[model samples]
Each structure stands twice: as C-alpha cells, then as structure tokens.
Target: MATFLYRIGRWAFRRRRLVGGLWLGVLVLAVAAAALAPSGEEADLAMPGTESQRAFDLLDERFPQSNSQGAEARLVFRAPDGRRVTAGENRATVADVLGSLEGSDQVASATDPYTTGAVSEDGTIAYSTITYTADAVDLSESAKAALQDAASRARSAGLTVEIGGSALDAEEELGGTTEIIGVAVAAVVLILALGSLVAAGLSLLTAFVGVAIAFGLVSALAVPLGLTSTVAILALMLGLAVGIDYALFITSRYRDERARGSEPEEAAGRAVGTAGSAVVFAGATVVIALVGLGVVGIPELTKMGMGGAGAVALAVLVALTLVPALFGFFGRRVLSRTARKGMRPGGAARSRGREAELPGRDAGRAGLGARWARFVLRRPVAVLMVAGLGLGAVALPALGLELGLPGDESKSVETTQRRAYDLLSQGFGPGFNGPLTVVVDTSESGDTRATTDLVVKTVKGVDGIASVGEPVLNRTEDTAVLTAVPRTAPNSGETKDLVHAMRSALSGVSSGTGAGILVTGTTALNIDISEAMSDALIPYLSVVIGLAVLLLTVVFRSVLVPVKAALGFLLSVGAAFGVLVAVFQWGWAADLIGIEQTGPVMSLMPILIIGIVFGLAMDYEVFLLTRMREAYVHGASPGEAIVSGFRHSGRVVAAAAIIMVSVFAGFIGMNSPTIQTMGVGLAAAVAFDAFLVRMAIAPAVLALLGHRAWWLPRILNRVLPDVDIEGESLSRHDPASSAPSQTSAAEPAPVRQLPVGRD
Candidate 1:
C-alpha cells in the first residue's frame, strides 16, 4: 500500500505543471456547473411526501382561497369596554369600514359589504372575516403590500383587529431563516479561513459549487421525482457542508505532509493516496447512510438521499482531483511557505512535532512517545474508569432536554409586522400565542357545526384549558382549514397537553353528532411527524449499524473485527452524546456557546450526530486498527499489536482530531443554531473519540478481549467473505489458538502487548 502511495507521489512530482493546469480547468468547470444549477423556486424537491410542491402550490390549488388569507387579515372589532357589541351597532361600523376598504386596491374579497357582520350566539360581540387578494398571477409583492396598506387604513378606522395565519407566518419565517442561515454560513467560512482568508473564501466557493450542482440535479428530477421547497434548502445545506468538509480534510493533510518532508508534488501525491482514501471511504459511508433514507418510502426522503449523497460524491471527486491538481501547480509556493516551519503537508510531520512536545515526555531512554504509551499502559483501568465516568456525567443533561416550537415571536427579528404579531398574541392570550389546531370537517359544512361545538365543549371542559375559542371556519376550493386557539402557549407543554385533551374530548365527537373531527395543528402535526420519524429511524439505525458492520467486515475480513468496530463506535457516540448533554443541554459551557440556558438541544440534532459523528469516529478507528491488524498478520500477538498500534497511531490520531476540531470549531460561531449545535457536537465527539475513546477505552477493551477479539464462528468464518486488514491474521487464522509472530521488519517494531486483561 505504501509502495503504491509512494509511486503516486512520484508521478505527481513528475507531472506537477500538467496536473496543476488540469486542476485549474476542472475547478472552473465544477464551479460553472454549480453556478448554472437551479435554486429556490427554480430548484426541484429534495424531500418526499410533500402535500404541495411549488412555493405557491397552496395558492394554486386553493386559488379560490388564496384571497382567503388577505381576507383573514382584515379588521376584527370588539368593544373596549369588554362588553359584547350588538349586531345593529356592528352593522353600522362594518359598513363604514367596508366602504373605505372597497376604495383600497388591495381588498380582493370581503364577507360583509353594506351590513354589519353577524353577532355571536351569546349576543355580546359582532364579527366578520374578510380577505384581500391583490393579483400578480399569484400574490404580487406590490399587491400584498397594497393589501397590508389597506389593512393599516382599516385599523385606523377603529376596528379592533387581529391577524394570524399560515401565509403571514410562512412569509415571516422564510425571510428570517434565510437571512440568518446565509449570514451564519458566511461567518463560519470567513472566520475559519482568517489567516488564509483566500482558502476560507475558496472553501465557501467550493461549497456553493456543490450546492448549486445538487440543486440543479434535483430540479432535473422534478418531473419523475416529486419534492418540496424545504428539500431544496435542506439539500443545499448538506451540499455545502460536505463540500467544504471534504476539501478541508485533504487540503490540511496535504499542507501538513509538505511542511514535514515531501516536495510540493510529493506532498500532494501522498495526500491523494492516504487522505484521499479516507475521503473516499468517508463519502461512501455517508452515501451508505443517506441510502437508508430511501427505505422510508418517502419521495422526499429518496430525493434527499440521492441529492445529499450526490453532493458529497461530487465533493470527493473535487477534493481528490482538483485539490491535488492545484497543489501540483501551486506546489512550490505551498510547500515553500508552509515548509518554512519544518514539516510536510501530509499532517504526519505536524503530528511528529506535537508528539515531541507532548506533556510528560522524555528526551532520552524512555522517550516522550515511550513514556506516554507506558503511562496509558500503566493506568489503563484508571483511565478507562475515569473517562467512562466523565462521559456519563456529561450525558446526564440529555435526560432533561426539552423540545419546543422552533421559536416564538420573542425569537422573531424585530419588525413592525413582528410587533403586530406580538401585540396580537399578547392581547388574545398565549393560547392565541401558539395554539394547536383541531379542524372540524364533515360532508357538509353545516353538519360540522355540531361536531365542532362538541369538540369545543369537550376542549373547554378539559383540566388544562384556560379557554378554548370557537374554531374559525374556512373552506378552500376543496379542503377546509380551521384555526383553533388553545389556552396555553403554542410550544408549551400545556399546548401539547391541550392537544391531547382535545383529541380525547373529540373521540366521541361525531358518534351521535353526524360530524367527524380531524384534529391537526403544529403540535399535533409534530406528534405525528415524531411518530413517523421514529418509524423511519428504526430501520435507519439498523441500516447504519449494518453498514458499519459490513464495511468493517470487508475491510478486516473478520466477523469479530466488524463486531469490535461497531462496539467501539458506539462507545464513542455515547461519550460524545454525554458531553453534548453536559455542555449544551446542561449549560456547562453556556457562557461560551452563548446559548444562555435554553430549553433543549434541537430534536433532530442527536439523530444527525449519530449518523455523522459515528461515521467520523469510524474514521480514526479504521486508521488505527488497520495498522494494528497489519502488525498482527506479520506476527505480533493480539495484545502486542494493540499496544504497538496505539503507540504508532496515537500521535497522528490526536493531531488529526485536533485539526478536525479546529476546522469544525469555526462553525461554533455560525448564526444558525442548527449548524452551531452540529459544530459543537462534532468537535466534542472528535476530541473524545480520539483521546479518550480511541486512546484509552478501545485499547483497554481490545487488550482485555485478547484473541477472542478477532474470533469468528468456524462455519460463519468460511461463509463470510474475507477482507484483508492489510492481510493481518493469527497463526492459522485462529485468533484464540495462534500466537503473534515476532517478526522483525524495516518498519517500526511492535511494542510488547500486555496480557489480555492485566490492566
């Protein structure tokens, strides 16, 4: 393997200029390809199971009701004296308001014209619902503006008004989230690339290239594959992440190797061979991971699976092909400048420097490397125990993690419209703050009234209800959507509680009433979505774990090897998860991340972490274990191999972890809470996986497992395909019976393996 790698390194040196020029050409092509790709409304769906595809799909199907939103936003008045206004009085007031609203160009439709709206059955207050739909083949920006202008004019007419619904909320969230995500992405890229701002910019550029291409590919698939608008942005986010990440790993590795000893071209070659291999493997693992999404039978999932993996695959291609080419052309300068520090760009040299400076080291007989290894060896049990304890402590906070609405108006960016929302929510009550909806529907709208009343009565009688407002009635060209306001805040548990209350209350709602109740709200929707996610995730977990097993089994050709790899990976995940619980969930580092004590980590974050970080944890595991197995096959005892492997691989693993951490740390300051969470979780996972999990627990467990660590059932062994962990095996392939060969070689000698469980 090294021979092949070395030869490739030489080829890069020989054709430096040619390779360099090729990189330039490819970079341009890749960028151009991405640039021409579709985005936003132009992009195709990346997710499956979308009810409506286009941003305006809702309006299209309900063209009859698109104007409904404008009407929904019209003034609603109640007497300030807290007394119910009479029908006669309301009629007079509504006439004056309607006349003025008619003069306005924004009002597309109104329920009341010359007379007052109907009085409540209680005869306290009179109310009406009106819509303004200014046309532009859709809701035009100018038209919506004019509509809002007309609403403002009506408000000045003294109609107590409250406007809240999906359209207004969607528009607000879209604008806020987009601006925030953009600024966050840019901030992360620039901050990390500070010393080499150009590299940071290039990283962002690379990300855009990947994102654009993925979007275009998704768009092209729209005819055959249905997708949603959210899918586009989701795919775009993943594309940029994988792209920058792919390039980041190799570019840093290349520079590291060059700084140590390799010539510019040589460094590039080595990087391509080693880091390149890792990249391919990483991309494959992610692809394997994303492929699991296809199992959900969701078009959106399949789209995301394809588009997400496609982006990463494209990124790997760029990293391997274009990056090396760039190095070949800019070889001399990159090498000269970075090499001035006395190392190569493969990252191996940089690590060596760090190893020499590690704490508790010796300059002589028991060298620094020797001492650190021995120290770990001496206290294996203590180290394992302490590390495990620390991990557990951090994870405790996860138990308390709270899930809530993405955010409320408090989290809303300051704007007049936002201010209006704050006022509306406050005036109406927090249930109006963020209520769960229970839509009442039947074959006939009239039939729905009794069931609706029943549902409302049941809801009002619930223990948690401060109040259950009458459902606001509306009908689409086909479907009807009712807005239900609960007594609790939208995201509060009380909201969830009230949703439960309403569901139980309405179970018998239509039994004798001749109406059926279909309860759906953000909270209810999330509950259903959560249930769906759980079902989707069950197979996903199995698939990911199974893939890990298959990949490792192929790489090591031992059932025992795959099993061991899976276990170690799990331990790493647990440790990382624990840390997340401590810092993010428990506010351990609240001062640093600037989270300032929030409810809980994002619900989806852990799932993402498990997939992404576990794959990453596997990265170091593969690197270290390969070298160990090589030693074992060449004839070192299993124990000896673990010791020597840990020793030889320790510095590199630690250095790689640190660099990965540094690169990811750049994201900690990003504006997006999601990305920021990812950055912290990833960094923590890498740190723990490398130093504690890999260095300490893994070695201890393997040391204790002894020959059994590589054991496989004889029948299964014969059937399971063989992969050469660089061709390492016990004497006769029986890890239990065969002892390691003490073969002497030109490479570093194997350190003595401790007894299976002497620690």
Candidate 2:
C-alpha cells in the first residue's frame, strides 16, 4: 500500500502541471454542473411508517377539506395606532390585503379573518391564512416574489402587516460572515503554525477550492436527491474544516521534509505518501460516519449525511492529489525565502538569526506539547482518573436530555414567523400555533357524527386540552376531522405527553365506536419525529461506533487501542451533548452568545452529533496512534513511542482543532436557530475531543496499558488486511535517506501481529 501511494505521489510530482490542470478542469465542470442543476426542496422530518404519517395520510385521503395538502402562510395584521383591527377602516385595509393575497397565483386559498372570526378578542390583531398550492420549500421564485409584493402593499397601508411560516423561512438567507470569520481565524492559526505567509495561503486556498467544489456538487445533487438548502451550508462547514486540516497535515509534513534537506520533489512525494495516507484514513472515517446517518431513515438527515460525506471525500482527494502537485510546481517558493535559506547547511547562523525573530519557529517540535505529554506520563493513573471523571461530570447533564424540534420561539423574535406565533399565542393560546388534527374513519358503521362526537368528548377530557373546535365532516359524511388545541406550547414536553395521553385515551373510543382515530398535525408530527429519532439513536450509535472500532483495529492493528479510542470518542460526544442540553435546552448562560431564547435541541441533533463527533474523534486517534504504531514497528519501546507520537502529532492536532472550532463557531452568526445550535454542539465536541480525550485521557490510558495497548488477537490479525498508513516501506526503500531506521536487521517482519513487549 505504501509503495502504491509513493508511486502515485512521484507520478503526480513528475506530472505536476497535468495534475494541477486536471483538478482545475474538474472544479470548472463542478461549478457549471451545479449551476445548471435544479434546486432541491427541503423534506419534512417525517417518518413514513410512523403513527403521525398514518394520521396525515388518513386526513389527506378521508378529509381533504379539513386542511390543504401544502403548508400554510399566515398574514398577521395589526392596526398601527392600536385601534381595533375590526374597525371599519382597519377592516377595509385588511380586506384589501387579503384581496391582493387571494389574487396571487401562488395562493391556493386565502381565508378572510373578518368572517372566520380569526381576529383577537381585543380586536387589535387579526390574521388571514393563505394556503399555497405547494409547500414553501417547493415554491418558485416568482411565487415568492408575488407573495412579497402582496405583503408590501399591506405594509403600505396604515396597518402593520407581517407574513410568516414556511414561506418566510424558505426565503431566509443564511449569512456567510460566519464562514468568513472562521476562515480568517483559520488563516491566522496557519500562519502561526507554518511561519510562512505563502504556505499559510496555500493551505487556505487548497481548503477553499476544495470546499467550493463540494458546495457546487452538493447544490447540483439537491435537485436529484431532494436535499434541503441547509445541506449546502453543512457541506461548506464540514468541507472547510476538514479540507484545511487535511492540507495542514500534508503541508506540515512537507515543511518538515524540506527542513531535513530533502529536495522539493522528494519532500512533496514523501509528505504525500506518509501524512497523505493518514489524511485518507481520517477523511474516510469522517465520510463513513456521515454516510451512516442514513440508517436513521429520515430523508433530510440522509441528505445532510450524504452531502457532508461527499464534501469530506472530495477534500481528501484534493489533499492527496492537488496539494502535492502544487508543492511540486512551486518548489522552494512554497516556503518563505527565509525558511528555505535556513535549510542550507552553510546557513545555520542565518537560520538561528531568523529563529530569534520568529516566535514559534524554534518551539514547533519541542515546546509545551512535549512537556505536557511528559507531565501526563509522570502520573498516568492520576491523569487518567481526573480526566475521565471530569469528562463524565461534564456529560452528566446529558442524562436529563430532552429531544424535540425547535419551534417558532427559538427563532429570532424579529422574524415574521415569531411575530405571527406571538400574535396567535396572544389571541387564542400557545396551542393555537400547533393544532392537533384528529382523523376519524367511520366507513364501516357510517356513523361519522356519532364517532366524531365521541372522539371530541374523549379528547376534551384529556389533561392538557385548552379547546376543541367543531368537527368538520368529510364529503362522504363517513369520516370527520377534529382540531384540538392544547394549553402548552407546540415544542413543550407537556405537549408531547398530552399527545400520547390523548392517543391512549382515544383508543377506547375508537374500539367502542368501530372507527379508526389518528392524531395528526404539526405538534403530533414533531413528537413523532422526535420519538423516531430517539429510537434510532442507539442503533445508529452502535453502527458508527462499531464501524469505527473495526476500521481503527485494522489501521492500528490493535484490539484494546480501538476499544479505548471508541470509548474516548463516546465520552467526547457525551460531553458535547451535555453542553448542548445545557445551553440550548436549559438556557445556561445562553445570553453570553447573544441568544435571547432557549428551547429543545433539534430532534436529530444527537444522531447527527454522534456521527460527526465520532468520526472527528477518530481522526485525531488515527493521526496520533499511527505515529505511535510507526515508532513501535521501528523498534521503539511502548513508552517511548507514546511520548514520541504525542510530540510529533500533538501540534498538528492542536492546530486542526482550533481551525475546526473556529469554522463551526462561524455558523453561530447564521439567522437560523437550527444552524446556531448545531454550530455550538459541533464546536464543543471538537474542543472536548481534542483537549480532553486525545490530549489527556488517551495518552494516560495507553501509558497505563503499556505494550498491551497494541495487542491484537492472532486469529483476527490473520484475517484483517495489512494497511500501511504511514509509508514505512517507502522509508526502507529510499537509498538517500538522511534518517536511518532504528529497527535491527534481525527483527521480525513489520505486520499486524507484533509481540506485546519491546524488541
């Protein structure tokens, strides 16, 4: 494997221009294809096999008149002077607004509040409902513009008007300033690490270009795959972080090679062959974890997982191919002139002079990183217990974790959706924003009215019931629909409990009346989605974690090592979820980050976070352990190898963690609460994984385990494939090698089955 990758690296170096041109061509093609592809629509987090889906289907089939198939847009109208909206002039203005909305080609039906009694009891506020022919995510640009134009006309009048719901959400533009902030921070970290502006720029450019290609591809896939627009944003976020980190790993190795006086081509080739292999492994782990998100069986989550996986895969390819090719093309110019000169034997004095001027230049290899590793080793037991307990403590809050979809309350209060929600809650009740639709089937007995009355009576007796509207009989008069509004807010735990209680209570009525009863609507659907995701979480975790352990076992040729890695990753992810629960659910100091409201974390956040964080945690594991494995294969003692691995790979992991955190933090600047919540969760996960799991607990555990850390069963080792992730064979074959192998010629062949003791 090492030989194969080395040859590819050499070939790329020899034909650098062609490789560079090929990538550029692919980039252009990607852009054009993406631009020409149809835009994708967002899929609701609806589970087809669930009770909520059954209820929705029954309603759509048996009682179409009860509600539109598509989503509804609410238009809230308030008199400017706090006058009653029912006043003659105010009513006239509202009528004109509804008239304009009714005339819109986008609207399937527009309800008049004056006749429907959709006005507030105080008469100061009223809202009309517009049901579109398609869902907001499926609406065309022309339709959206028309809706906007109608709203503008309403605002032109003396009435205060706001249009809300899925329509406005569909039109919301997530900002890029957060990404820019992330990039800016990444660049500064790169410059500090590389000590060369050109090198830092190369890393950033490589990452940016890779992410651009991924964004284009994700956009292009949207139409064909029915992906949400948020997929592109997520792809961009993952792409930027992984792309830069992959490039940094390769670039850092190349710089190290150049410093060792290797020629540019040799350095690029060796770097690509060695660190590039690790990048491939790390990136593949990320891709696998992301793609595994599909197991949850939610279409939106599947698309997001696929999009993120695709972006990371492309970034890995670019890191392995284009980055090295560029290094070949630029040669010594890739490094700063001062750094390049310092590599010369005669320029030792000049290098010393330059080192005095550069802050981190001399401290790169033997700084606090090495000292920290040594410090941990001195008290491995103490370090292991303390770090483990600390992480467990941090993760304790997750025990009380509550899962639900974020509602209008989580949105910016300034948004039209929030305004509409507030007005409705004020006018009717909090439950008005999320009505429960009960679908009754009486085709057998043909006693729809009797069943409806029974169902309504049963629902009214439920604990959380605020009100039950009159039943709307279907055209066949064999089925009826009832709307039940609960006192609790849509996303509240009480609402979900009430939904379950209502269903249980109605079961008796359905059996007695010989009719089918189903609870459906936004509130019921959200609860169903949450339950589905929660049920899938354990299985999803098992798959991703199980796959990770198998892959790490193969790569590291160890049983205990993989076990430790998986457990550590779980700890990191748990801590991240704990933080998420605290900040988003409990609103613990949420105001520090400018958050004004708190709510339940998104339903699928746990699965998404587990998949993402598990992969990333393994990235550091692979990079660090591969170095230790390499050292062990070359005859270093287990203790020496652990310390050496830390010294060698710690710096890169630190830099990569910083970059990832900054990138994720950028999404906090987005207007969407979903995005912001995800940003914080991912950022916290990376920080915990890097600082606690990898830096502290991993080394401590390994030190305590001694050589047993790399032990693998002989039977399993024989079946597993031999994967060379560090290019050890290349090092052996090279005749001009400046660093001699530490392995004795009498030593056994380097393979998965190594003795559990020093040679």
Candidate 3:
C-alpha cells in the first residue's frame, strides 16, 4: 500500500499542473451540478413502522382534508391588566385580525375566539386559530408575512399578540460566520504547529476545496436522495475538520522528511506514502462507522451518516493527490527559513546511514510528549487511575439521561412561538400546546358513528386525558379523528405516559368494536421517535464497538491494544452523555452555554455522539500508536518507543484534535436548540477522547503493558494480512531513486536490537 501511494504522490508532484487542473475541473463540474439540480427540501422526520407514522399515513390516505395533517397558527391575544379581550377595542382588534386571515388566499379557515369558545374564563386572554392550505415546509413566505402583518395590527390596537404553530416553524438561517471563525482558529493552530505560513495556508486551502466539492455534491444529490439540510450541515462540519487535519498531517510529515535531508520530491512522496496511509485507514474507519447508521433504521440518521462518510472520503482523496501536487508547486518554500538554512549537501547520505540509530538516540532533545511519556512510565498505575476515576465521575450523571425531541418550549424565550406557547399554557393548560390526535378506522364496523363514539369515550376515560374533542368523520365515514389534550406539558414524562395509557385503553375498544385505533400528533410522534432511538441505542453501540475493535486489531495487530481502545471510547461516550444530561436535561449551568430553556436532550444526540466520536477517537489512536509501533519495530525499547512516538506525532494529533473541537464548538452560537445541542455534545466528546483517553490513559496503559502491548497470537498474525499502515517498506527503498517501484517482500530488513530498560 505504501509503495502504491508513494508512486502516486511522486507522479502527482512531477505532473503538478495536470493533477491541479483535474481537481479544479472537478470543482467546476460539482458547482454546475449543484446549480442545475432542484433545490433541496427540509429533512423528513417520518419514522416508518411506528404507530404514529402509521396513523399519519392513514390520515393522508383516508382523510386528506383533515386539519390534523395541515399547518396551523394560533394568534394568542392578551389584554392589558384589568381589561378583558372582549372589551370594545380588544374585540375589534381580534375581529379585524381574523377577518384579514379569512380574506387571505393562503388561509383555509380562520376561527373566531367567540364562536370557538377559545377565550379564557376571565375573558382577558383569547386565541384565534388559522389553518393554512399547505404544510409548514411548503408554505409561501408571503403567507408567513401576511400572518405577521395581521398580528402587528392587533398589537397596534393595544392587545399583546403572539403567533405560534407549525406555520411559524421556518428553518433557521445558518450563517457562515461560525465556519469562518472556526477556519481562522484552525489556521492559527496550524501555523503555530508547523511554524510556517506557507504550510498553514496550504492545509487550509486544500481543506476548503475538498469541503466545497463535497458540499456541492451533497446539495446536488439531496433532492433526488430525499436528504435534508441537516445532512448537508453535518457533512460540511466533518468534511472541513478532517480535510484540514489530513493535509496538516501530510504536510508535517513532509517537513520532517525534508529536515532529515530528503530532496523535495522524495520528501513529498515519503510523506504521502506514510502519513497518507494513516489518513486512509482513519478515514475508512470513520466511513464505516457512519455508514453503519443504517442499523438504526431511521431515514434521517442514515442520510446524516452517509453524508458525513462522503465528506471524510473526499478529505482522504484530496490529502493524497491534491496535497502532493500543491507541495510540488511550493517546493522548498514549505520549509521554515531556519530549517532551509540548516540543510547541507551531504546531509541526506549521512541521515540515511544513521537511520537505525535515529529512533532511540534522539532522547537528549526530547519535547513535552517525551517528558510526559517518561512520567507515565514511572507511575503508570497512578496516571491510569487518575484518568479513569475522573472520567467515571463525569460519566455518573448519564444514569439520569433523558431523551426527547426539542419542541417550542426548548426555543429561546425571545421567539414568538415560545411566548405563544407560554400564553396558551397559562390560559388553558400545558396540554394545549401538544394535543394528541386519536384516529379510529371504522371501515369494518357495522356502524361507523357508534364505533367512533365508543373510541372517544374510552380515550376520555384514560386517567391523564384532560378532554377529548368531538369526532369528525371523513366523507366516507370510514375514519373518525378526534383531538385528546393531556393534563401535562408536551415534553413532560406524564405526557409520554399518557400517550402510552391512551393507546392501551384504545386497544380494548378496538377489539370490542372491530375498529383500528391509533394515537398520533406532534407530541405522540416525538414520543415514538424517542422510544425508537432508545431501543436502537444498544444494538448500534454493539455494531460500532465490534467494528472498531476488529479494525483496530488489524491496524495495531494486538488483541489487548484494540480492546483498550474500545474501552476508552466507551468512557468518552459516557462522559459526553453525562455532560449533555447535566446541561440540557438537568439544567446544570445551562445559561453559561447560551441555553435559554432546558428540556430533555434531543433523541438523536446519543447515537450521533457515539458514531462520530468513535470514528474520531480511532483516528487519534491510530495516528499516535502507529508511530509508537514503528519505533518499537525499528528496535527502540518499549519506554523509548513511547517517547519516540510522542516526539514525532504528538504535535500533529493535538493540533488536529483542537481544530475539530473549535469547529464543533462554533455551532454553539446557533439559534436552533438541536444544532446547539449537537455542537456542545460533539465538542465535549472530542475533547474527552483526545486529551483524556488517547493522550493520558492510553500511554499509561501502554507503558504498564510494556512489550506485551504489541503481542499477537502467532496463528492470528499469520492469518491477518499485513496492512503496512506505518509505511515501513518506504524506509528500505533508496531515497535518491526517482523511479517508484515495489519492494520485494522476501528482503525484509532485520530489526536493530536495543538495550532493555526497566522503569
């Protein structure tokens, strides 16, 4: 694999123009495809095989005109203190607002508060309902503007007006400011790590190009594939992060090779051959984890996984080809001024002669990583215990984790929808914001009306049921739909329990009357989605953990090493979930992170954290451990191998982890609660996995295990194909040779023997 990649890198560097031009042409084609494709629609939140989904499908088929299936807006009006909404001025204002809505072509119907008995007992609060002709996603901007205009007139007449409902649920605009800030921070980190402006700029440039191409492709294919904006957003985030990091790794390796006295082209080839191999494997692991989201059987999550996987794949390709070609253009300028000055004519020959001694003999000028590794070797047990206990303490809160879909109550207090929700709850009850719809299919019943009446009565008898609306039958009288308001808030545990109780009670009625009964609504849909996610969590974890262990075993060629990596990943995930629960569910210091209202964590957050964090955690593990394995194979003692690995790969891994955290943390500023939750969760997970698990606990564990850390069964070693991920084959080839040729497997280099050491 290293030989193959080495040839491609050298070829790309020699033919820089052709390689660069091809990527540019591909970018142009991607842009054109995006421009010509139809615009993408919002993500579909439909869950197949769930009761609420089945109920919804039945409504669309049997009662197409049912108000339950359409978008609606409630114009909540509150009069001044000591005044009633029925007073002359307030009543006239409320009437005028309803009249304007009735005149609008977008409105199917506008119900007056008086006629519908929507006024509160004190008459100080009232609300008028306006049903739209289209779904929320399909509603025209003009329709929303018209609604806002009507509310303004009511406010002008001295009545407090707020609008809420599906009609007002527009997609929030995600500005590029956050992305720009993240990229700027990454550039600074790169410059500091590489110590060259040219190198930092090159990394940023390649990452931006890769991300743009991936985003364009995803956008062009979105409509055809039924993908949503959520997928695109996630794709962009992961793509940008991995693209920059991959380029940074290759660039850092190229600089190191140059410093060791290799010519420009040779250094570029060796860098790509070595670091590029790690990039490919790391990227593959990420792709596998993402594509594995299909096991959850959720269409939205599946799309998200595929989108993220495509981005990572593109990042890998760009790093291997475009990066090397760009290196050719930059040539010697990629090195710092000091580094260029230090190079001499015979340095390459001298460096090659001492290659065997380089790994263990560099201890005199050790960096922070080397110092840290020495400390871990001295007190491995203490370091491991400290890291484990700290992470476990953080993870303890996960036992109280609660998952649910974020609703209007989770929105910022400044949003009109949240204000409307609060007003409705005050006037009526908390359940008013989330009414459950009971659908009774009476097609097989002898008397449809009798069956519908019996179903409604049984629902009303449910303990948590506040009230059941009158049943409205379809034109064929085969389906009857009624609204059931619960006695608690939409996201409350009681509401979820009420939904379950209503379903159980309705089952008996269905059995008696031979009618098909289903309970559904936004509230019920959320309940079903949450439950589905919860049930799939364990299975998804098993698949992801099993895959990670198998892949790591192949890369590291050790049983205990792979098992240790998997366990560390579990700790990272647990700690991440614990933090999420503390902030979003328990409201622990929520205001510090811009969380205005706290509720149950988003249902999709845990699965998303596991899949994404597992992939990234493996990336750090591979990049760091491969260096240690390479040092050990070349004859460095276990203690020296740990120091050698850190000296070479520590800076790059730290920079990459920091870049990822910065990019994800930028999303915390977003207005949407769902995006905000994702930002905080992913950022925290990466931080824990990168610093605590990989950097601290992993080294300590490896130090304690010593030579046994790399042990593999003889039979298993022979069965598993050697992947050559560390590019050891590159070391045997002559650096001065221009022609890229495969090396013979029969001529394996003998390992150098070093003195054994006991810490």
User: Which candidate ranks first by lDDT, i.e. highest?
Assistant: 3
Off by over 4 Å in 3: 36-38, 66-71, 102-105, 133-141, 176-178, 345-366, 734-749, 752-759
Per model, state how many residue pairs clash: 35, 0, 0
- For lDDT, candidate 1 versus 3, the one ahead is 3
> Of 2 and 3, which scores higher on lDDT?
3
Residue 270 accuracy (lDDT) in model 1: 60
Q: How do all the candidates rank in terms of lDDT, highest first?
A: 3, 2, 1
Comparing candidate 2 with candidate 3, which one achieves the higher TM-score? 3
| Per-residue lDDT over 1-759 for candidate 1, one digit per residue giving the tens place of the 0 to 100 score | 333433454475566577556655655665565466433222212222422122124333534444354323434444445544454655566566556556455555555622442344444434344555522223445545654554565456554544433224331122244334543555454433222444454445555556666666655554455544444444554566556655655665565454333446556666666656666676778777766566655444466566667767777666666566555544344332323344434432333321122112211321433456556656778877887677666556555545432443423233333454554454555665455545555554355555566676776676766655555554532233455667666556666666666667776765656554556644565444444454555466667788898887666555666776676566666666666667665667766755643444554555556666666677677767765766675567776677556555555455456555654555565444555666677777777777777777777666666676665556554566544323222212212123222232123334433223211
How does each model score on TM-score? 0.68, 0.91, 0.93
What tens-digit string does per-residue lDDT give for candidate 2 at 1-759? 666766677778788899889989988998998989876766667778777788777876876665555767888888766578888887777777777766576678888898898887888888888888876677777777777777778788777777777775663364577768888999999887777787788888888889889988878877777777788888988999999999998887776665544566776778888888888888888888898888777878888899999899989888888888888776666665557656555421122210122224534544666788888889999998998999899899999888888777777777777877787888778888889988888887557787788888899999999999999887878878889999989988889899999999988987787788889888898899989988988888888889988998888888899899889999999999899889987889788765777877888889988888887888888888888888787677787778778766888889999999999998887877778878999999999999889999999998898888888777777788978887877766442343323232222334444753332
lDDT of 3 at 689: 94
* RMSD value for candidate 1: 8.6
Candidate 1: 10-residue stretch with minimal lDDT = 354-363
Tens-digit per-residue lDDT, 206-231, candidate 3: 99889889889988998899877778
